[model samples]
Each structure stands twice: as C-alpha cells, then as structure tokens.
Target chain A: MHDEAVAHEFQYASASHQADTAVAGMWLFLATEVVFFGALFLSWIFARHFNQAGFDAGAERSELEIGTINTVILITGSLVYSLGVVLIEKGKTRAFIMCAAAAWLLGLAFMILKFAIEWRHDLDRHMFPGADFGITGDLAGGAKLFWSFYFFGTFVHGVHLAVGLGLVAWVILRVWQGAFSAAYLAPVLVVGLYWTFVDIVWLILYPLIYLIGRAT
Target chain B: MMRLLRGAFSGSLGTLAALFARLSPGKKEGIGWRVSGLLLTWAVMLILVGIQYGVSRLHFAPGLRPVLLVLSVIMAALAAIVFMEIGKGPGINRLFAVASLLWLLILLGLGSMDPFTRVMYYVHPS
Candidate 1:
C-alpha cells in the first residue's frame, strides 16, 4: 500500500500528477513505436500495390486458420490483462493476480502456437524468402517480397510480445509484493498500455499478413 | 502429501472463483462498470475477427480489399481508445495519439509518391 505521507516522487506535486505523467510518458514511447511499425506497413503497401497478383498469391498461401486463432488468442489476452488492471484499481488484489496469471498464460500460448507450430510449419514448407522459397514462375519475385514482409513483420512483433510478457511478469511480481494499491498503480497502468499496444500491432498485422488477397 | 496436494488444488479453484466474481457484473459501482465495458470490448473485437475471417474466404474485387484493411484499423483504434483508456486520459495524451497517426500518414504519403508517379521515359533521337 502507498504511504499517504510520501505518496509521490519529489518531481511531482501529487501522486495523481505523477501517475498522469507516467502514463503520458508511455504514450510518448508508443508514438515512436507507431512510426517504427508504420514504415513496415508502408513497405507492404508499395509492394502490394505494384505486385498485386504475386502478393495475393503469397497471402493465399498463409495459414489462415492459425492466423485467425492467434488473433483471437492475442485479443483475448489483452482483455484479460485489462481486467487485471481494473481489478487492481478496485483493490481486489487476489483477483487481480489471478487475472494477470491467466493473461500471462494466454500470452504464452500465443507464443507457442506462433513460433513452435506456425513458424515451424512455415519453415517446413520453405516459406522463407530465399532460394528454397515455395512459390515460383513470373509471380515469384512479388511473392518473395510478401514472404519477406511476413517473416520480418511477425518476427519484430514477436519480439515485442516477448518484451510484453516480461513486463507482465514484472507487474505480477510487484503486485504480489503489495507494491500497488488503489492510490498508486502507475506501473500497472503503463504496462497495460504497452501490452495493449502490442495487441493493436497484431490486430493491424492480422489482415495484412493473412486476410488480404486470400480470396484471389 | 495428499493433504498438501488437496490444499493446493482447492486453493487454485478458490482463486478462479474469485476471479470470476470480480469479472462478473454486479451491483458494485466501479468494478461492475469496468468489467462490463471490458467484456463488451472483447466481444466486439471477437465479432470483428469473425467477420474479417469470413470476408477473406469469399472472393471480392481487388479494389474492395482496402475496406477490409480499414476494418482492421478500426479494431486497432478500438483497442487503443478503450483498453488503453486513452479517452479518459489527459489532454496531452490525446494530442500525442493524434500526432502519431498524423506522422504515419505523412510517412506513407510522401514515401509512396516517387514510385507511384515515376514514368519510364525515353529521350530519343531528337
């Protein structure tokens, strides 16, 4: 629990002010991340615009079933984590911990499904953008570009997910130590912001990677 | 040993029950509102996913693909605004959010102009 007397940092006027600043600071970091991912999206736009047939061909090759499942898992994890944050705010510490654990497990499941099953399956089919690439003929170059985007985009997003899992783990430990209360839970809020942003990235990537051109 | 195992098992069940209670909407003011809102967000996102996947399975005009992409952007926006509580945040935070999107637009716009506009030309025998 927060000590009422020394509730905030020396730099802040009040505990609430400090919390607001922390949340704002997290937003600033996410703004930079927006640009970072935006560049990749731009590349994809150019590639898809010029090479529609090949790009669609590559998109059709993606594992739609697994992609849809992962999307469900990730978005569900975001909700579970959000619930944990709300529960903590209401001073339901034990329930909050349970929610956090559930969210973490969901995140772990996503990773396992993504890297172990999906990626392994992709490699088996030689989806990597190299000599052994599965697609061929006149559309091969564009298809290769699409595969490049798929591998790079998912890899970068997976790294972010790994980082999010670490943050969730840290939050779980801190909350378990009784470091947060209704009065002081900025860390939880910041971590929640980051985790949800990760989910948002995946949400956008889902269609680009798996949905677009599948009907072709 | 059996007693210890049983205790742990029951304890796990108790924790799950408590979590369910916290998540269930109730007469409680703040907790109920928050839980219901989050659950609603989850349901909406799930429904959107269903629609998106179903749409992808049927053939559509290439020009219509952007519509599906726009739906995805909406999902991302919904998560940002609701789950992140950006709507309830301070004014400056909203500014930052808007600025990030504006920057992304600038990047896409200017970056694409060259390739999209380039015309292969020949300065021939003149």
Candidate 2:
C-alpha cells in the first residue's frame, strides 16, 4: 500500500495478477507487524539490560521444555501447511484439507500448551508480573520486567497464530468450493508465508525467553 | 546442577534447531537461508545468555562488563535479521528496511523519554 493509487490500479491479466498483488500486500503487512513486534523486543532489551540479574532469574524458571515442544510443534505445522500448498497445485483437495487441518490442530496444541500448561504453571509459581509476583531478588522489579515482556511477547505471538489458524480454515473452505487449482496456488503460498513468519517470531522468542541465563 | 543447566536450554533451542534444520532443504531457494538464520540466532542468543549468567556467577573482573554489554547488540541484530529476513530479496529488503527504521523510531522515542528528561534537568537545573 505504498501508493493509494498504485494499489487501486489493477493493471494486469488473469487472476494471477490479483494473486501476486495479494501476496505482495500480505508481505508488506507482515513487514509492518515485524516493526510492531520490534518495539516490544526493544523495550524488553532495555529493561532487561537495566535488570540483567533479575531478568536472568526470571528466565531461569520459565518452562523452556514446554515452549520448545510448542516450537517444534509449530514448525511441524508449517511443514504440513507447505505440503498442503504443494498438493493444492496437483489438485489434491482432500490432502490440502488434511494439511490445513494438521496445521490448525498443531496451532491448537500450541495454544493449549502456552495457556493451559505454561501460563497456569507460571501463575501457580507466582511468576505473573504485576500480579502475585513474589520475587525477592537483587533485580526484583526487573524480574517483573522480564515477565512483562515474556507474557506480552507470547500473547501477541499467540494472536498471530490465531489469525493464521483462521487463514488455514479459509483455505479449507475455498478448497471445498473448488476455488483453488493448479493455476491458482497464490492463496496457499501467501498464507504459508504468513504462518511461517509468525512461527519465525516464536523461534526467536523460544531462545530469548526460555533459554536465556542458561550456561556457556 | 548438570541436569538443571542442561535441561534449561535443551528444550527451546534444541527443539527449534532440530525442526528448522529439516526445513533447510526446500523447493524455495531462500527458505533454507531463512530457517538457518532463525536457527543461528537462537543458537547465538543461547550462547550470550550463557556468557552473561556465567559472568554473574563468577568473580570475573568488573571490566568484562563492556564486552558482555556489546553482546546484547549482537543478539538483538540476530533476532532482527532472522525475523525480518533481511537481504532476502529486492521486495523483502525494502520491507525490512522500512520496518526496522520505523521500529527504531518508536522504540527510541518511547524508551528515551526518561533519559531525555534528565538531559533537560542538567540544562535547566531546576
């Protein structure tokens, strides 16, 4: 959407042009999302710097195991989605739906792990920032800062995953209606790019939050 | 102690590395690069955290602080490059550039508010 007039201008032949436009626009939008998440990363970096010890302490207790499993699960989902894209080109709608379903199920698994397991565990452990955080360390307040970023980062990433799941369902619906074909695979590719980007963000978070403060 | 330390990082990076490594070979030429970039970032950040924690535990000279501090910038760059997929292509390059620039402005604008107040303090000396 760099130029309002440019976006409105449909100067191309066939639906492929529209598809490319959609792909380009989605990519540009993801670029904006990156900038948005970048702000959170900055705030966390600054705050964590000021309170490294506290942040390290907070990082120590985080459920890296659970988070790592979720990371792998999401990656598996991305691969399934990719396979679905490939199958769509060959006109395999049933397989396409299966791949989309796998991605959606994996996403649900991730949410369950993040919310039901990890978040609840943190709450029970009194690790929730600004809520019953009973941290008594050199960087006590900074510990809260760590949790603040941790929770917010994971929460926003989860929202992206939710939207990605929506896209997966949309793909399934379009497949059911025979809306996609070998000639029209842009939608699947576009959503894969988006879902993978979301997964990419979590990839960074997996290490930063859960693995920080480990050993050399 | 062994299990605690090993168990700590074994989950996130270990898992991501394994999964991402398989995706390195794909029909897309740049996908491997993207996955590698993401994996490398997580690996490096894990190292940096280890260094920081180890320093805090030991009686390392206070002077090592400067080196450790510089490491944070490196870690941040890794995260940015991986997430932004910088240098991926002409199309993505422009996107990453604008996105990072915009992020920098917003972050510094909000982050420096407190320090800027201190700068005004010395100038006005109220």
Candidate 3:
C-alpha cells in the first residue's frame, strides 16, 4: 500500500480526512446536478401534460429497440466500472485496469449506438423538430415539442456521457502511473460517483423518453 | 451487590457486540462477500430494467406510468446506496445525497402548482 501520507494534502488533518472531504465535495456537485436535470424533467412534465396525445404519438415513433439496447450497454458499463472499484479496493491494479478498459469500451459502444446509428435513423425519419419534421395533422405541434425534448434531452445526456468517458480515460492513465492505491483511492471513487450519476440520469430519462405513453 | 450488577451489565454488552460483529458485513466478512454482494445488486438492477421494458410494452392504463417512475426511483436508490456507498459514508454525505432529492421534490411540487391550478389560457378566435 502506498503511504497515505504521501498522497495527503496539507489542509487535511489526515489522509483519510482528505479523502472524506473529496467524497463530500463530489456529493455536493452531484446534488447541484440533480437540480439541473430536475429542471429539464419539470419542463418535460409540463409539455407532456398539455400535449398528451401528441407526446404519446411522438414516443411511439421512437426507436425502442435501439433505446433498450443502449440502456443495457450503459447499465453494463456501470457494473463493469463498479467491479473495477471493488478490484482497486483490493489493490488489484491490473485487474482494475482491465475492468476500467472494458467499461470504457462499453461506454463507447453506447455512444456509437446513440449517435452514429440511432441519430442517423432519427434524422432519416424526420424526427428532428424543424421544417422537415415528418409528423403532421392536429398532433403536429405536440409531436414537435416531444421531438424537441427528445433531441435536447438526449444530446445533453450524451454530452455528460462523453465527459464521463474522458474522465475514465484520465483515470486509467493515472492508475497506470501508480497514482492510486488501496490506501488512496479517492479519485477513483469520486469518478465512479460521476459515472454512475450519468447512468442514473439515463435511468430517469428512459421512462420519460421511450417508455411512457408507449402503450397508447 | 453493586459489583455483581456491573459484571452482568458488562457481560451483556460484550454479548451484544459479538452478535453485531457476526451479523455486520465488516472486515471479517472478507472481500469476496463484498464483491458478490455488489454483483448481486447489479444483477437485480438489470432484472428490474428488463421488467420495466416489458411492462411498458403491454396495454396498461396510463395511470400505471407512475409505477414505472417508482421502479426507476428504486433503481436509482439501489445505485446510490450500493454503488456509491451513500449510506456507509459520513452522515453529512448522506444528508447531501438526500437533500438533492428533497430540493427536487420541492421544485417540482411548487413549480407545477401554478400551471396545474391556473385557468387554462386559450386565445379567442378574434
């Protein structure tokens, strides 16, 4: 184990204290993020409430199969990253690196499915909310609103995932450089928190975007 | 008599501690126990996802939408508690975690009050 004192910051009383502070800070940031995404969710509720039929029609038009597959990919990525956390806690650096690499690749797959494949399909279907939008009739207004939310929500979410991917890559580099050990795993733990937060956001988004109003 | 009472009390305390030590997932539980426990949580979450997807496909009442939301909340709680170790963290950390959700509830509840309660505005065909 690396000496806790070596990684210890001067401000904290002990290495453990510093680690605790780091985690608490991450939680604080995540709290703000909850409210940030909460605003988006609130807007979605209002839009759907006013335009129920239109929203349902728009939701039905969504690519459910691709959405489900991506959901699985993201969830599996989280699980892999979590296993890496456990491995690192045991000081199994090599095994942890392997898990992280696998998780990172899963994240990449999620992005490709979402952007390269799904977005292309959406564009071809005229799902983009604009002059070229395909949906018409009395429900056009609401369906347009629904697509607006879909594109905006997923795009914002994709940005967050992209950021997470970069963080994971950085973590892998740092871990390879021997910056982390069982005694000093705060960075890894906080990054895991961020990654999982992204996943949780997707969980909340899944029902709102793809599942809700599907039956109708 | 006082000495005998003290000894009995101490003995009971020791017994309670021993029970806790056995029951808790402490260092004695070993790494394998922790690893498997985490994997179990992951498995259950995936199963819940499958259930959510399947239920959405059926022709259920729209009111059942809340059930899906509830399931998602449960999954989020699991991830927060297990993957993030929110409960095992410091009390202040748990407070931070809960506070976000609380604030969101307040935001949603109050934010919707105006739109939900106010008379519907429609432009007259002038």
> What does TM-score give for chain A of every model?
0.96, 0.91, 0.97
Point to the candidate with the largest DockQ.
1
- RMSD each, Å: 6.4, 7.6, 12.3
| Model 1 misplaced stretches (Cα beyond 4 Å) | A1-6, B1-29, B120-126
Per-candidate iRMS values, in order, are 6.4, 6.8, 12.2
Of candidates 2 and 1, the better by TM-score: 1
Each candidate's TM vs. the true structure?
0.89, 0.66, 0.89
Per-model DockQ:
0.41, 0.12, 0.24
Per-residue alpha-carbon lDDT of candidate 1 for residues B2-115, written as tens digits (9 for 90 to 100): 354345335644654565575576766657677777777777887898789888888878767867887788889889877898987689999999999999999989998877
Compared with the true structure, the alpha-carbon lDDT of candidate 1 equals 0.84
Tell me the tens digit of each residue's lDDT in model 1 across A122-193. Answer: 989988988989999998988998999999999999999999999999988988898876667899999999
Query: How far off is residue B85 in model 1, in Å?
Result: 0.6
Per residue, candidate 3 scores C-alpha lDDT tens digits across A1-216 of 244455677787778788889889999999999999999999888888788889888988888777876776777678778878877887888878987898899889889989999999999999999998989998888898899999999999999999999999999999999988677898998999999999999989988888997876
> With candidate 3 superimposed using the best TM-score fit, by how many Å does residue A127's alpha carbon deviate from the native?
0.6
